[model samples]
Target: MPKYIMILLSIWLIVIDRCSGVSSPIKPFTLYKNSTELKNDTADLWWTINDAWKEITFELHIKSADWIIGLGISSAGGMKGVDIVVGWVESSSKVYLQYAVPSTNTTYHGKIYKAPTGYSIKRHAIAHKMLIDPKNVNLVHHLKLYECDPMTTLNDDQLPDGLCDEIVDEIKFCSLNFATVWAVGGDAMREFPEEAGCGIGGDYEIKYYMIQMHYDNSRLDSSTASIPSALTVPPRMEQFAIDSYCPSEVTRNIPKSGNNVIFALPHTHLQRISVWTKIIRNNAAMQYLFNSEKYDFNYQYENRLLKSIKLYPGDSCATRCIYNTKNKDKITSGCERTRDEMCLHMFTYYPRMNNFYACITVNDDSAGVLWIQLR
Candidate 1:
């Protein structure tokens, strides 16, 4: 080949090799403040390489901050016999240490290292602590070998049950941002506590849970039954109210005797029901009796006459009533005193201008009658 062509080919090969996973020297990482007045105290480190290198090292520089309290590593595939070297600079001197983490059979491994030196060593491993001043630290570097794949032949059975449990515990303790869990084998099941064990008020309580089950659909046998069903709160309990409608569609008749009373109707619908009270005094004519001039009337063919009380659909005996006037006056005043006293009725309906009405009742004699007309 021509001399120039040979040189160009060599350069291209080197570039390709690097791109195709050639191991290289340690990469320098840095942390900086967004504002000079406010400090950034959090950081994340990620290691991603398919091949195993001769040695891996991490160097850190921090200023005006406390020591790094913990360290963690996650294996996307699987890793074994991994060794790490950590080093730091303190009081103008360098401190370092080495540690090994056994390959986890299930999930990722998290280890914490305490300060190795009385003055807070600059670097340590597994569970070690390192000290650095936020203003003085300047350089952080990671060095790793780049030659052999460390996670190519991992299998599910190689993982330990405790590994998965550990992962869950970490997620619970550290408040991790994201997590993913997978189940292996046909018989394995994942479980979590229904209530947080801390016994605190803000603790998480998992009432209803759903999990996706995945298997080879084609391999499913016609005779093979599905996993037993789990106990779940009824859909009606979650999405709809148990007692949605109040004063259920029963009739209520206010008697001639004035009395303070409270009424309630059960509601099951998840929506809010409006309960209204209407006084229909015995006028010479029904039209004059319901006219707006005599009373602030909002009478609907179904449940409009009584406008203040609302009865949700699922409520049961959820209605309430209280008489405001004295017994003799209430029975004798406003056309309600005669054999046909003013009829006080209660109705429940939605807020729409003309929605389907749910329940209504008219007062008769000394009692009230409630009726459910929704069918």
Candidate 2:
């Protein structure tokens, strides 16, 4: 063990021994002389003292010729010019005396002193003021004092003027007067949707939904401006065209016995236009009953086709066709059709409850198919 650890262990052992009821002998000494000398009662223990001081020492006799000892000093007037010397017979000696004068209020106030070995000693003074109520303040007098406001009830009728008056009422009157002036000048704004809601047929039922796009169209070519011409109705609708007198120009795909179909379409460009060709099929024979064009060829802007349509799901009738125009001018002009103009039908038909697939062919001939669930 290290020397310091050994010394600590010895001190701990001494404390433990005393707590366990083992008592060591204490020797008292008075320092009326300038110096005092301590004698070692055993060979293993030694002691010495220098200078004037009143103190006591303790000695413990352990094994033969071995001893443990301690020293203490006490004085009613406080010790002065005192020195305590300690050593073992064959060990090193150490001085445990301080050569310092106790500080006095006037002598050491706000001053610093150094030891003989140049170690500095510092003294500080702290001043404090006691406050009973720190937040008590008077604004008019510009002073802080311990005062508190008494608790009181509030009366709404006694409130200050303009503190709680009807500001909103004034604003409403101004708005109405401005609107009346506008109406008198024939410059009134159009009826808002909320106002129009009450007058139309006594509360009509309106449903709103969004069509979400399911495919990416970043690869479409901007320059290809021609719609395909080889638009064909699904092959299963051939017989329905004869029975229903539906013109061959329209082809409709209806389910023979189901209530819904999973329809899918490809993401097409904004310039792409499409038409809905209706095909009426004979439910009994599963044959095409009629084929007809129910609506004008509708120009399908990329935005409309890519957006999902939210029609009445189970029994809704769709008579719209989508078409794309290569010419920007034609697109802007609502897909004007010429005498010899031709367009493609970009749709896939299947039974109402079956899976439906639709594809869009880009100018680069790259096509992508999308699947959609119909209810």
Candidate 3:
């Protein structure tokens, strides 16, 4: 009799669980800058996103309907992480501001979330910072911001819960230029030099920057930006090294005008002791684009070069990473996971190239790829 009673109670609980509801706030309007609606044919407005990181502006003129008007921008629909500016006229004009922002988001499952670019016109970003929830840092392996063509119309606002890559069409990209690549141990802030800037938005032909956040049961997983499989590090070896080469054939995509490198971020997991990039021209050495005498996984930073290095046509670059795996009893291979390993050199340069997105590569076979001796 007790067993029968328990079965009835279990069925009742299942019904209650199925009846519970989760509601997300309504989708907000898309502000594509060129959008101007003369509300009932009486208003004229022109607004757009600013050059600074995350800001927007508006100017509206209306014949009537004067009580409250707003240009609201928020991460959530209702109130959480809101940055809204409202105004009205009666006596000396009044403005109401509600500003609160929490830069990170948490999740219970694996997913990809995207945020709007705010601006659809040419704007230059001078600096950017990584914003990860301190408690959930372990969940993030990498973050990338992709530049897409100017979006005249975005279907819906990806707020509260971001645009799920699984449910939607895989977001398309128009340019090879990635705005940023932040990995596991990267520094919080990265600033560009005074003379140059990364170009985006309309006119620049690359607008609508989308921040792509990758969170799985563990780390970042992007089939497009796949890191080369790691090299084998034998147990009890004094030192192990991995190299990645961007063959000159691949570098032909670089603009004929050439590139001036301003900053570099060299990344690897815990075993790495040092990392550097060697540039080559005419099959001969040119310079070390960037180098680290000692690397700290805990203090990973994107370094701004004091004096920029130049990369012309017919130039190629290769990355080398040295590891200390002498204490381990097992072999390690290059991989994307936090527990595995990687060898990557990400650099920032401008007169931003539209045709060439990356010389991106990894040299797995030492026999096939070799760098010229250093000058």
Candidate 4:
């Protein structure tokens, strides 16, 4: 073989090895930042820890104007529901830590069960409400085979009469309840396993973990941020895995109400305006899981909660994603293509158990396709 050809072949093999997870470094944590010129950018710091480093401590720093920065442990990528400890700098430069858990429907089997007999009252959709009552218990009730049309102009008559608890089978996303796990803050040394029985035990193992940082360059044009983060462990402990709640659909819209963990939804391009996921309890109380008022397609991250929110059997998870359909001038449906729109919610949460799954009203169509080929 030619001298140049041999050199190229060697480089190619090295690249292949790195891509195949063969060269993944065994480290406590790794830093990741976007090299792009975009002012609003993100940095994802991953931790490839195994059973050897189960109990460890983490220390982090942000270079400048730290609007959104955090350390997270995930099963998949950063976008998937991960157990993240997020922090934001206030106007007084005080940083506060909030435990965020991504919501996924996949963790709850992502299925909708039928309403038993005597469950009639009808389901209400996510229609526009000009005048909403603060104590209104009708809008957030569980619906039986309910449909929410994004373009529909909702009037007072379209709203539900009162709380409807007809549905029997609904998936609950209560596994990612780790508010008491470990506390994190700015420039502070935080320990994972603070003491004995502090870390996650059993068959759970952390396959992938990452730390993501978001820099906001709005007021200070040239201001910068940097975080010197670290994690230390005793070298041998059982690891735990983190999973999310993502419910996808090639067809059908989200149902009205059920006891499901509906966290966040995914959209492509400029069609989406906002996405809101809420939990409607049996007493007619409302709790928001994830809310993205100004949805941006460029920065598509799961809407996470500061703490884990539980859902009972009768409670339903509701999601509403608005779009700008007026510009297209054509009827749109769900598809993978860019021109088409998708109502898929990448639900993210924790506690990877056999019963966790999504609660969409339709059956998944992508199950039959082979995993090797490209989508």
RMSD, each candidate, Å? Answer: 28.0, 40.9, 14.5, 24.2
Query: Cα deviation of 239 in candidate 2 (Å)?
Result: 26
Poorly placed runs, candidate 2 (over 4 Å): 1-256, 261-276, 283-354, 359-375
The models' CA-based lDDT, in order, is 0.23, 0.22, 0.58, 0.33
Q: Candidate 2 lDDT, tens digit per residue, 127-149?
A: 11222122321101111111011
TM-score computed on alpha carbons, candidate 2: 0.15
lDDT of 1 by residue, 223-326 (tens): 32222111111222212111112242232322223222222122111111222233222221112112221121121122123223333332233322111222
Q: After superposition, how far is residue 308 of candidate 1 from its true place, in Å?
A: 99
Question: Candidate 4: where are CA atoms >4 Å away?
Answer: 1-269, 283-285, 363-375
**Can you write out model 4's per-residue Cα lDDT over 197-305, one digit (the tens) per residue?**
2112232231111111111112222222221111111112232111122222210232332223323435333466676666655545377666777777655543334
Q: Each model's TM-score?
A: 0.14, 0.15, 0.59, 0.30
2 or 4: which has the higher TM-score? Answer: 4
lDDT of 3 by residue, 70-91 (tens): 5444433444444444554433
What TM-score should be assigned to candidate 3?
0.59
Residue 164 of model 3: what lDDT? 36
lDDT assessment of candidate 4: 0.33
